[model samples]
Target: MAGAALPTAELTTSGRPILLPNEIECSLLSNVELEPEGSPPLSSSIHLRSSFLILTTHRLIFVSDSSAAAANTASYVPLASVTHIFLLKKSIKSMFGSPRLKVQLSVGSDGRVGGMGTRSIVATLVMRGKDDVEAFVDKFRQNWGARVWEREKESESASSGSSLVVESSASSSGFDSRGMRVVGVAGILRREQEMWESTDKSLQDAFQDLNALMSKAKEMVMLAEKMRLKLLSGPSQAGSSNDEELGSKEEMQDWLLSVGIVSPVTKESAGALYHQQLSRQLADFVKIPLERSGGMINLIDMYCLFNRARGTELISPEDLLRACSLWEKFDVPVMLRKFDSGVMIIQNKSHSDEEVFARIKLLITRPDALQMGVSAGDAAMTLGIAPAMAKEHLLTAESRGLLCRDISPDGFRFYINLFPEIRTDDIYLVKDQGIYATWIKCASSPSRLQ
Candidate 1:
């Protein structure tokens, strides 16, 4: 059945709304409704029923109940469209019934609540859930008064000009007294001197007190970001940058890029919702990091990286585990995986040992790998993953009949999956057309070039 016309709002794959950059979720309620009260006789004839209301810092989203035998749809009422919110009338009769808070919102002439510069329209909110009415009202007032959206706009504008402003000021300071000199030994010397001075000053300042270090953390993060941008733009500016300089610049950029998390979730910040919210945020945050780590990352390694990015708001290992366990409750794209060896990792849900096995199979089938078998470190480099993670992948593949383990004083290693190829009836037999024959041929060759 067709439902009432409702505005649509986008939701992330994890079911969270795609908030504007810098916008944060404040409060969430499961089930609520909206309806107009005390309208004209003709207008009052229209009835709106139970729905789920989500109160964000910027908008009120009403999602219609699915069982309404109508299209489950969402409508958004921007906070900017709200002019006044009437307090719930307190009385014995009101206290006995469900709490209903009325909100006065300005709607356009076309009878839609919006902020597209149209005339005002009045609307009311009827809360039918077991929630703190006063709390919701207070949040609404706080969000309206804070005007965070406006502040975000100002911040974006400031950041856009910050680089240009800094460059102009630095140019006026006459730091570059020498006219265009070929960037060679002299440039490297000057850069080394600047880095040493900066590092020395930072070390001295950091030792002053814990509080001083905490205070300087944000500036340190900004400095790192600035340095990363400089490295990224340096190659573009220097037409004759050497390969060695470019490689160093890339390394520096990577180090600096890992430096900060502007708004890390903390136990204090998320309160009772810490684990749940952290799980979702961590799931969102780890995608790129996991991809860079080659589809899997050790839980302990992730804990360190996460805590380092969080700076002072360090969470306990227990908290990290709890957050990881909560991934089952969410629809995030990543999962917390535990190997038989009791090692834990965060990996993409789609990441499979079969894929890693395919790569390992291809690697060890080569003449060199066939002869030596692949050590954990060798596999780590070949698979582009951590040595421990690669070992786990290799073990998993071994269990799945795609590889075999080799343990000796030389160290634990994995070889091509010869178990399936080797005839159990004739262990020494090498089929002319199979991987066994190819592997034997590669293994027997004195020089791989043969």
Candidate 2:
């Protein structure tokens, strides 16, 4: 249990594997077992049964099922350490019971797992779950044979040489005179212009097919992160820059952050647990946006923002709703809320409605707001929330006797509640300086002033 022939895998808060850079999930199976068939039980035999199995481009991951009686820690076998994946026996017994797969792993002299060594052990994966065993087997072979892990090394080499390649490509495409005094946003734009001009072929190839687009995914995220870092470092380094330039750099940094999700949970990868995993990812993604939007965001706006960050893996509106709904089952910091009017929004659970109400209370008491009142749009701008949601809050305030509504040529508006100040005994009777009198005075403003 302590030292197995496999490396311990790290999991996210929601118990999903934390993938390697550029790694992609290929398949998953629940309630599987990893058994070692040696003369005796091998010391590396994990003794883990009925666990979850995940196959990715780089590793075969095992997760403890939630219902298991033991501690839930994950373990993985890197395809880099896998020496062989034995052929399935396809016997009649296998067709009746659970299916099993055997893979040879490289181990150190002491029989401990390592990236590579001379000693080896055949790991038998027993599939006891309701998964497509054949599909799992097929993908396992494809991932093992493809050896995509090797591509990461090659990609690193290429990336190290990318600057030289980019310079050559730029020179070939006539990227202005090198002496052009480019700097700041203008400089970034100028560089992008040169890159686009020189990489027109890559742009065209990217959209040629879905496969081509998939290949460009990493580069896109890297570019976004790179720009984000540059923008982040710009202001500190910009001693002579104007306010407008610094502001533009900050805004550009936000956009770059929003545009990149290095790893998005996809339906193809998560399978039946797609919505659950997507919910966890969304919960994490929305925190910064929610903070920037004042602790809440319109569901529709988030849908657009989330999909934009997702790039080609766009989801349906229904999928978004389902993912939001799954947050109830997760311990994420955010929650989905639906107003009485059927508008949906996501807000931090710790966000206080009392603070929002306090803001609205102060807004309603403003001298101008007290005289003419404020519209839903006005409250929205003040509260940094959607107009529809702001209206809901205003209505709640009205119900609580904290505010009052008026509909007139000025459109529907909310004012601090003055109904309790009016004396019903005599309509003519008004307190000297009460809110009722103040309201009457404001209500009688000159038509020309109105």
C-alpha lDDT of all candidate models, in order: 0.70, 0.79
lDDT of 1 by residue, 216-317 (tens): 765566667777787878877898988998888888877776755555666544445467657766776787789888888999989998887777778899
| Local distance difference test, candidate 1 | 0.70
Model 2 C-alpha lDDT per residue in residues 392-450, reported as the tens digit of each score: 88987888789988999989989899878876888678889867776777667784275
lDDT of residue 189 for candidate 2 = 85
Per-residue error (Å), model 1, residue 187: 26
